[model samples]
Target: MGTLFGTDGIRGRVNQYPMTPEMALRIGKTAAVFFRDKTSHKHPKIVIGRDTRLSGGMIESALVSGLCSQGADTYLADVLPTPGVAHLTTHLAADAGIVVSASHNPFYDNGIKFFNSRGFKLSDALENDMELWILDDHKKPPVIEDKAIGKIFPVSDAGMIYSNFLLNALPPDIKTRIGGMKIVLDCSNGATSTIAPNLFSRLGVEVIPLSTSPDGININDACGSQYPETLAKKVLASGSDIGFAFDGDGDRLIAVDETGNILTGDQLIAIFARFYHQHHLMENQTVVTTVMSNMGLGKALSDMQVTHLKTTVGDRYVMEQMVASGAHLGGEDSGHIIFLDAHTTGDGILAALQFLRVLVSENTVASQLANVMTVFPQILMNVTVNAKPAISDIKGLPEAITIIEKQLGDTGRVLIRYSGTQPMCRIMVEASTKTEATHFCGQLTEIIKIQIGT
Candidate 1:
């Protein structure tokens, strides 16, 4: 990660350091110069999309001014999801795409993420180069004159366009595969508020929508994928067969079954893996997942005779591994799923539809599908820190982790890392029993807090 970028992208509280409008202008300028030089286009075309945050308009305006001033034409895909921006970037053959969203963060927070012309996230080297350009003191944005100035175009009906794109990508029997299902959708009152309702309605299912109203500040407030309990309760009250919750930018998905039981992404992945292997739906009998995925998923995949690959915590890392291994499917435990055959990035809505396909094709309920994996007892705890020090340098932290790892041996694992986006440390422990996992995680939590607590 760069000084201004995280594992995902550039994110922070609105109006703060890198997220401020002034910084957004610099980012736009840097992107215009960087992509224009990399691509052969004299007047590079860039697409800009954003979630429904109050600061979105402010950021987009500043970015546009910078890009236009730098001689790059910009297309505005207002209030669209992150993946929608990716799709638009490729669909319009633009030089690159930029999304102004903080994803699952609150409305008070905002972010910027870039996608190349091929609709994939920029690599660390590319981001680092852009960061260097943005911070370079001697370099200045060129002043264009006359007809050389760039223009801004509005990508009207962007939501509908992306919806149609997703629908068209499904199988010919998609309607039959997902027809007549009763479902609940929690859009998190963010980017998917409009797109999800419009997209899911075409599938012939009775959809009960919740949290679709975005008041700017309400995005991800005790709802969405972060709190599947909200969707679970609604599913039970509405008597829906299943429910799905999407984060602010519609890149992650968490689900609720007919029994109001929330299913983890690992569980859903296992179900998909088993079905694809039985039906021979996968082009490569391989699936990519992050290290955060439950160990049970690997066991289940092994039993089903499928190749499983693990990457770092981020979706970009998962995507890189998928590409390298020629795997068509990849995702994280937090619900960011990628179907590389259909889309270049992780898409929550598309994953939901694909999950629906499995449900109907097998003629079963989500509660039963969840049985594909038996989750190992796991606990993830985050501790706010005054400063982020290397975990190895924190006194007693490494020794404690070592002790736990030795005790765990083959039955479990311990992973401790700092949050790439926040000023905190996360401790994750998985063990054969819930009690053991909890005990070990508690020990690490206290150690982290004592070492760097505020």
Candidate 2:
């Protein structure tokens, strides 16, 4: 169980060291005991959900066995989005919720993350304690009598309940104006395959679904948020007003305009930030995003006098900054938008709904709305590394950055960091032109590859 947790939670290729069934069982036992002791609920209870990965059932069974052994009555939300699991945990009054997924990753990769009773990620302190407990060799789950053993129950209406709750968050005016909109959805053949279509139909929109059939291994196979070209083409061919591509777990969204151009999350954030500021919807006139966001977003938000607070790469870090600053709107370039005024965590459908509302209310097309910010030409490159190391400690990397910084000046920026969930160093360079960005990125990529690339 050595440092099984990452920026989000425990994730790896299924059947591997920390991602194996044994580790999952230990995690289940530890979480069951930890959250059980901390909750004010009448009894120890937990809700478990998963995406459409083939290994989901294997890990889910292991988790259930461990939870039941420790007498945590487990509710199984068979195939639900990560955010839906969070909602069910809070609504069902469970002590905690665990989602089995590797958002946006391939089907072979799976992960387990938890939400507290309030539908929020477990605090770092809680996670640390749980990790320590899981790692302790002397700690073992106590055997319970048959009568005291926890039982498993199914949440048959989890999708419906979550969808209705999302709809309820919308105002009457937007809801009324949103009808008659024709939209396309590429579900990524994962958790949102059914739920997103169902939710959109409830809003009286004509739904055109793509990649909705999940065959376990097909999830995120060049068909999701990470690959929106297919969705963009469909929107053009079908003549739909807009298209949305959701990641495997449905916590991220990448949208395509009517012109078949995929809109970056930075563009979407710029739109929302300006709209929130104009409508006085911003809690502190702030919009928080990751450092990976396009520089243009910062310039646009700054021009409009909206505070553009930047955090580290992870959505967890973004959420922390947003909560600390009381910002109502925050997102990432990866499309993990968190609307504090709506749901607790990032919900792709919820963000899509809000974006659609803006489209309707402003009486503008998505392409025009997206033009709220100019997207700076950016290039992102990833290098596989043999081991993780502090970026500051990477020899020669700092000097190279300083030199590149001098060259770019005020027109652009560069960001280099390790992926929290993968063994890769991501290099992002933004410049006034793609040629300049590529040159800068190539320089950094070679240095990192020479230092640590596998």
Candidate 3:
């Protein structure tokens, strides 16, 4: 009875202890029962989508078996992005949406995340209920009666439905403004392969789509948001107006300007925040970001007279903080943006659309999008370390942090975090210049290695 769910969902190496087919089956059954709403006149329906993982099929079958066993109908949207599943769940008025993906994690990892009927992620209380049900061996949902077994159905038009929804959500003027916009899209060879190109083409933008394969292992290997260097090169070589890359689940997005400059989540958020504020669309004049956000973001927001709030590292945490604060925009530095007015979760496609909306409204180039923020030069280094080191309890870690803080003063920032999913420590530094940032980050990393025995 170990904890199966991670920061996002139940993610781990496929065929491993927590991610095994048997566990997936139990999770499906537990979710089916948990989401069973007797008040509804119709039967409960759950939409499930997966990434291009090689193990996707095996896990999908197990999930379907469990859901059907509990009298819950399941719709199989094979190889769709996580955000697409979230959108469809709300569009179809289903009881819930389930996404099978490991997001930016490697091909060997897989997971199951879900959205409740409100088109939002399951709350912590709900997650705890399901976990308890899954762990209690002797306590199970009542076995389905003979005539109540559920059925599995294939959603053959999921892609088309999602594409249509995206197009319809945009203003007609957007197409005319974007007609000559040259853009390159890296689909990460995952879920967006089914929808992004179609969405962009409908908007009358010139779209050059790369890495749009369904090959599971190849996805995000050297492409996608995690590795924007390749996309930056492609943008430079093609002389494209700009480039956007999506992670395996298509909920995170990273971009490169025409000049081959990679823009991170904070920069992108700054662009949107400024645009929304100008148009008076930014509700409450606040933006939510994770603690991992660069200090430059706070400074920029402050200069703009916009309040910025920080939450935990995960996008879910950001969303929770946003909703509680009644904020209109929130996201993580990893490119998980939530335009709460439009969608319920972090959607790469939606974020791209918002960026385009701003670009068209401002009538400016991509490079100028975040010009006001002048992103501080930042460097990050991750080192694999032993499992469960006393990172917070390290003897000299606090002293080292104090030293870095004093050095940074008001012009820079430093952050050291433990990898949520791996045995690693991530050290990040930001300064006025790249050389300074790199040097500072290197010294701090050396200190960590010596102190933590990494």
Candidate 4:
């Protein structure tokens, strides 16, 4: 009876609650019905893809069975990125696309997200309709004739199509100029395991790939974006120009500088914004980011006389705001960068390519490209509690926060918000220097914990 989908999708630990195989089948049928057109007669078609999660096989089969039961044709593009599913949906003109992935979450978790025919994430309105159908038990099984049962076929070129598209999206000179550039990529052993190495090799970069495995459990296992310490060390040890780490689903990306410094999504945006401007590719010279972006990014954009817009924290919200504002580039601080000129959804592989394009075009190094923006030191700490209280009910919390704000003044910023995907309150502080930011963050977190700790 509760809402079936979370901020991203229907996610839970494998075999638990919403993630059970039975529920997955139900969701698949509901999705097929929602996308079915009675007049098509050729059968509604949908494409399904998944990350390297241990539960992906079970979930994928359940989805296939349910979709077929509705007489909906299905295409299987196994072990592909989330964006690849989105791309294939629109490219092949399928009625819908389904992806089984939990993105940056650990291997124990899994999820199901739908993409509309246009290759964009489904709107809240459409999801609401599906929820209504599920509650009313309006779903109908297929009334298929003996020959009308839908068929499932494999897409042998799914990775090649996505990789080729990413390469073409770059400026022509990038491939030649970045041919000798040395870079390390940690694919998280998920979706990028197939596409990334081929894409970079085709681009002529000296690529060193880590975590390249088909095994599901290996994804994000002390590598990848969420666990960057391993990648940081690898970058230094390999002495590569830099490194890029992707999430399990390959929609998000984080970077390591030549000095082994981790670069967050905000810093990457600032760098790309500057590069795009230098090449006259930044339309209206504006960039879109979430409120979670660092104050340093705003300062960098302002210094360049470029515009910056802030949306809510999620990539979906960023995409919506970008569309409304006619902005071409937008993303979250968690490495979910979107280049409207490249792909409908954020693609980690594409993002890395774009970064390479800029470096090659300007004949610059990764460290030099990174210098386009000066990142303020940021400190964030999350406090887990029994319940998430309203921001209004906590007395003196606001006053204490105000003190930190005044302390930082114009040189920094503070963000205190709740984690939508988890039960925790996060306190973030950004200042001109790391020491000052850490001190303020420590002080604020201690105060809030005392006031709200269980």
On lDDT, the candidate that comes out on top is 1
Residue 144 in model 1: lDDT: 77
Output candidate 4 Cα RMSD: 2.5
Screening candidate 4 with a backbone cut-off below 3 angstroms (N, C-alpha, C), the clashing residue pairs are none
How high is the lDDT of residue 17 in model 1?
89
In order, the Cα lDDT scores of the candidates are 0.90, 0.89, 0.84, 0.83
- lDDT by residue (tens digit), candidate 3, 325-423: 999898988999998887788989888887887788788889988686777788999876765456667667777778878987888888888766655
TM-score (C-alpha) between model 4 and the true structure: 0.92
lDDT of 1 by residue, 162-194 (tens): 998889877878666686778999999999998
Worst 10 residues of 2 by lDDT: 1-10
Best by TM-score: 1
Ranking by TM-score: 1, 2, 3, 4
lDDT of 1 at 78: 92
Candidate 4, which ten residues in sequence have the lowest lDDT sum?
134-143
What is candidate 1's TM-score against the reference?
Answer: 0.98
Query: What does candidate 2's lDDT look like per residue over 371-413, in tens digits?
Result: 7888899999999999778888888999999999999999999
Q: After superposition, how far is residue 297 of candidate 2 from its true place, in Å?
A: 0.9
TM-score to true structure, per model: 0.98, 0.97, 0.94, 0.92
Q: Stretches of candidate 1 above 4 Å error?
A: none
